[model samples]
Target chain A: MSPNKLLPLLVLLAVAPAWASEPAPARQKELVHLVRQDCGSCHGMTLQGGLGPSLLPADLRDKPAEGLAATIYYGRPGTPMPPWKQFMSEAEAQWIVDKLMSEFPQ
Target chain B: MKLILSLFLAALLGACATPQPLRGTGDLGLVIERATGHVTLVNTSSRQPYARIAGLGDLSHASAVYSRDGRYAFIFGRDGGLTKIDLLEGKIVKRVIQAGNAIGGSISQDGRIVVAQNYTPGGIKAFDAETLELLAEVPAEYAPGQFSKVVGLADSPGNKFVYALFDGGEIWVTDFSNPRQPTTQRYPAGKQPYDGLVTPDGRYFLAGLFGEDGVAMLDLWQPEKGARKILENYGRGEEKLPVFKMPHLRGWSVAQGKAYLPAIGRHEVLVVDVATWKEVGRIPVRGQPVFVMARPDGRQVWVNFAFPDNGKMDVIDTLAGKVVHAFEPGKGILHMEFTPRGENIWLSARDDHKVLIYDTARFTKQGEIAADSPSGIFFTARAARIGF
Candidate 1:
């Protein structure tokens, strides 16, 4: 194929992975509720901290989003945090991390 | 003038009439609102919240035991605050901070002593049920100044309390026969006894082990025999997943001659023959089971999950030994309580901020009560049961 024809194909491939990484709007809503309520059970309802550590944006500012996502996906061993891979995918975990880093849902 | 005087007298009589108070009949209960650090007094008969009593501190992992009269509830909070609330008046009668951190507690069979299992100071404290006065303190000391957190504290037969030492890997039985100076007997349980519960008949006290694949069962009748491992290697040979939340053995169900228990780090319920203490069957569920409870009739066993799958619940047929039905009553379903006759089942959906009551026979939503992040549901009917 010519250079011009290959350019469009490369662009499409690059955008496809990004599109797949984003969870659907409905799925995002469910993830938000899960983090707010389920995770909120240990980490306070205000994300301030309770039996578990604080999950507020300020406390998590120094933590990278990728590390946070991995923690959510695979869970931290020896801690109360359990693996959520059974319920969500890695991409979805990344999305949750991004939301947590930003303004988390109420 | 005569007609006006008669109307005034009738109005005076109407104003003098006071509302009737709730009498103890094993129909009342409390829903622990974890986030708000309060409990909502609920009338299971009317399926309505009568009152919300606050001031209990750090209820993130709170549990309650009712008085033998079923009129008072002794709530154990995570912050080590033990509050005794009068169910009739819906008020805290006595509150005391007995430790630095605590998980749960139990009442003695004689109804004279209440014990709080601690995580901070690492010991068990016995208090007078009526006065909330500290009667005894037994530190769970394993090494020099090293105390193990206590778990699975349950009232056994003969006014004794049985509990597991999380760090010590031992089960201790404290006889409160004297109340003031209790005698304790310790037995080696498996590694990491996370939680435990006594059977409905108070014959067996089973503790769920987190560091291993099986559970430790203690025969209360034969205390000399010590704790034995039951359902050993139930999670053997499989790549175990991280346990998000520890399976609450308090909700372990016994029905139709079998005990339904949530297998740690697995999406299955292990059904053990209560008579044989052997695994008889395993039922696959949606996710990690949290609360595996049985109806009062022992015909159906209901199971709830942890974290991401906490929204859904499954019903297992005890006779058939299979999951017959699965439904999502609401988000963040925390606890379940069956009515005295098994006519209705009440579930707390913390995310939805409501408690959904279902008709047991048809499994239909009967009613819903507004609550504030409720987690645990306790009914007066539990006061009559063996291990509340």
Candidate 2:
């Protein structure tokens, strides 16, 4: 392919899926609420840790995002953390992990 | 004209100086607004909220214990906030950040002390009910540098407190007779005792196990004997569902001759014969039960569920051994409290931001009070109960 055509193709590939990767704005709000209320039942509402570990940026920084996403999607077996796949998509779980790795929304 | 003006000023001054009515807190209660760190001081008799007091932090998993007089409420917030609120005064008397993470707490039999259960740097700390001053600290350090999260801390008879160690798998009883220098007795409990409850009679301390099939029971009358397991494998040979939220058991779970308790990872409420301490029956319900409580009359049992199923509640007919009625109050049905005589039940619909009151006998809505993400509904009558 020509250089100009390749550059345009690259931009389209990069921009299109980026929007698709994260959940939509409305669903994003629901996911945030899920993390704050439902997940907050065991993990502290402040994400400071309770029966479950903390999800604050400091606590989640060292952990792999993929592992955290898997934990959310599949749940940690033999633990109280139940699988959330029925409630959210795997991509949504990854979005939650990314938010936890940074500062979670209030 | 000057004399008339003076008289008017005198009357206005007298009205301004007059205090609130001389009343008791017998009908007063509290509604914890979890998300906003505020508590609505509600009068159960009127089914209305009189005041909304704030500043208690991170009440996500908060629970409260009443002072002996029923005038003060000691709120234990998840963010480690131990706030003592004066119900009569409609204000916070005192608050302290005594830990990094606290689960719940209980008051002594004499009502002179309030003990808080902590998860971070796990331990149970005692404070003076009057001054909120530190009285004692019993570290849940089962092993060196290893502390277990304390759960189900209940005040028993003889001015003692009993609690379960989640990580250490033990039950510990401490006598607050000498508040500053308390003595503790430990008993080896089953694996992962998630919550503990002192029987209404104050004779037994039962720890609900999460990692195993049975609950550990200790006879307070005979402390020499070790804890024994009861309700062994009630759900054995069955596939266990994921526990979206842990079940909570209080002392008042017993009704008539049976005890209605939450079944871990199961969609039923396990009924055990209190006399024999064995599973007599089970009532299948909507989802994993969180709070299984019997009305003060013991004729009916009310229950709320955990996440994904958290919006529904079941009313069990104790005599029929089955769920007589079920209803979804709203999203996030967090907690429920019945009146002293069990005539009316208050249900906290957290996500709906309302506290709905229903008449127990007719199963009809009586009132709904607006709140901000309400969770726990505590009444002053709890002050007179043994293990509130």
Candidate 3:
């Protein structure tokens, strides 16, 4: 294959893992419960605001999804937002970010 | 005509029969639902929630203290709502919003007064336990224009309330023996006392320090000596993980003449000898320990951590001074309470919306009761215990 054709194949191989790493439907449901109830302990149950800030779609609309996912993964230092990396994978954090951007599950 | 009259008489007798009353040793309790500001009345014997009462307001960090008879519960809410709940009726008897922002509260030793410690517009207010009527206000003012947030308010032995000044770094004891003119005494504790609790025997009041690396202990038997720092520099040189939430020392684990305290920003519980006020050892845990609770018999210490690892739980054998068992009961395990004799442990898994009951002896899942986003579990048996 030509070099230009090889580049497309490399890109596809690189991105394939990311797409395949999405949490299973059952796992996604559990994560949804965790964010809504566990995280909701600090952030309000509706994600409005409490000990932590509002995590609603409207409040998080301005921030980039990737940044939010990173925050969820690494956590904000010196804050009550704990690192979810121990409990979740990078892909799972992204899944939470996507859910937060839309109407998060109750 | 005779047969009709007999049926009518039977129906009248059935209608007049009164309902049977609740039995068992008043082991009933309330589980604070943080999300919706409600409490679920639970009976340990039945292992089920009988009723749920709502509208206490901002129960995110709420706590409750029982009346002497254990029939009434005084719920202190985060939004400064003090609600007096009747356990038998499963309803709020009276509620009063006395502050802008409140943390927790304490009931006097005599059970006559209830005191709430506040954050916003910082002060402590005393109210009549029966009526929820404000009796007095003691502002935590360190300077002319500065007000310190109150933390770790606990009722000591002599009808007195003791609390820590988060901003002022001081511990104050207000004797409500007089009710109106409380005799106040101040002692300098460590920096930023986050939460405090009286010992089971009500001998010492220990406060966890947030701004520093030690705990301040005040001997209630000898208040003239003032607060002394223990376990100093315990976390001085160690690199700390980012603190998600401050470890609450209110429900600290005490068993067999020792205390198992959560070390801030560390996945370890500091074991302290109560007699010597010395660090005996540190038990490594699965994550940052939130509540290190001793079993009723002092044989094991059960620990639950902060988020990410909140799903995990560790059971430490008090004698071995090590984690014997670690399990994930469910996601978001918030609070735990053991049966009076420590036969079973009731744990609130907030994410699962269930309170799991585990057999302490066999360490097996016995049963579970459905709850909302539950956080704190308080039982009527606490009414008889000191510093519950």
Candidate 4:
């Protein structure tokens, strides 16, 4: 493929990776439980922040959704944030970001 | 004179009579309702909640330490709310907001003072165990204008508070022999000491390193020697998976001369020799471990996992050095506590909102107590333990 044609595809992949797919309802419930209990271990169960940073809507309002999804999918290199790609797809991370930016489920 | 004697005897009998008979605090304990700012006082003997004390602010990751007499429980809240509640009366005696954000707390060896480790102000705050009065503040300011979150606060034998600094990568010891004029000594731990624990004898403090591949150890008997690394390069060639939850190294991790610890980013329990601080063996489990706690008698070590594996719990037989029993107790098992003599073990299943009681010897379900998003299960038995 030509460089010009590849550039737009690269942007598309960067925004939403090729391996993107919305999780099913049952999977979504598991994801919610995972975020609440597992992620809550570092971030407070209230998402008010602990050893890790807060995940409340206000704390995440300023951050970009795609970048947040990337952080969840690939993990922050230096920090304690570990990659979730082993557990969920990149699109599911974006979905989590959207939920965290709004009101997360119980 | 006979009429006066009869009246005095009746008065004495009336003063001693009450509806709800007296009970000792020995069988009492508290369960933290993580979502709600409340705690339920339960009787381990009957497996029933005697009282549910409300109005504690933000107990997301709460922990409690008992007074030497086991009368009052000092609750260290996540929002830095230090509360002293009477186990016998089942009432909040005194409460104080000490800091912005607190991780946990420890009671001094003398039990006269309680100390909290804060993440917001990044320091340790000492309080009077009785009145909840702020006694002293030790800021974890490794450098000017920079504060680091404090973790793993435990009371030592010599009226000392020992803890780890996550951002500063240092372990600190604060001697409260002179509460007003306390002296502190700092030792450089590894990259990130997530949490800490002192040995049962209160001789050594070990910090779990998150940034590196080792555990940091400091001998309280020899503070001048500084902190040293143990189990270095345990995950050298192995690619570490995502550590959904950090491994916790609290009390009762050591049993039968071996220290059982949760390995970070790996589904294994690292066993270490307390005498030499060396990696003795690794017991592979279902997932990354959150709490590797030993029963009171040190015969079996119980471990719970993080995330997907959180529902499973495995018991390690100290004699065999292997997980002899594995079972799915419930969903979201957060914390576990054993009765004073290791007769029964209580586990808090956050998702199910129930505290499941199991007979340690047979691993059979004894009873379950319904709670609101329960997490930590602490018993008055912890009062006798050096680190809780």
Q: Name the top lDDT candidate.
A: 2
Interface RMSD of each: 3.7, 1.0, 3.8, 1.1
Q: What is the C-alpha lDDT profile of model 4 across B149-228, one tens digit per residue?
A: 99998889889999999999999999999887789999999998999999998899999999988999999999899999
Instruction: Assess candidate 1 and give its lDDT.
Output: 0.83
* lDDT of model 3, residue B109: 88
lDDT of 4 by residue, A19-39 (tens): 266578899998997787678
lDDT of 1 by residue, B1-388 (tens): 4465336434533533444364755789989988778787888889876776879987877889988888999999877899999877767899999987778899888788899998778789999998999999999997678889888898887888999988898999988999999999999999888888999889888999988899998999997999999999998769786666667889566788888999998999999998889999899999899999988889999999987688999999887889888999998888988888889999999878778999988889999877767888988766766767
lDDT (CA) per prediction: 0.83, 0.87, 0.83, 0.87
DockQ (Cα-based) for each candidate: 0.17, 0.58, 0.16, 0.50
3 versus 4: better TM-score goes to: 4
Candidate 3 lDDT score at position B345? 93
- Model 2, B273-307: lDDT tens digits are 99999888889999999999999889999989988
Docking class of 3: incorrect
- Cα deviation of A78 in candidate 2 (Å)? 2.4
What TM value does chain A in model 2 reach? 0.80
Q: Higher lDDT: candidate 1 or 2?
A: 2
Q: Which candidate is the best by TM-score?
A: 2
lDDT of 3: 0.83
Model 1: docking quality category: incorrect
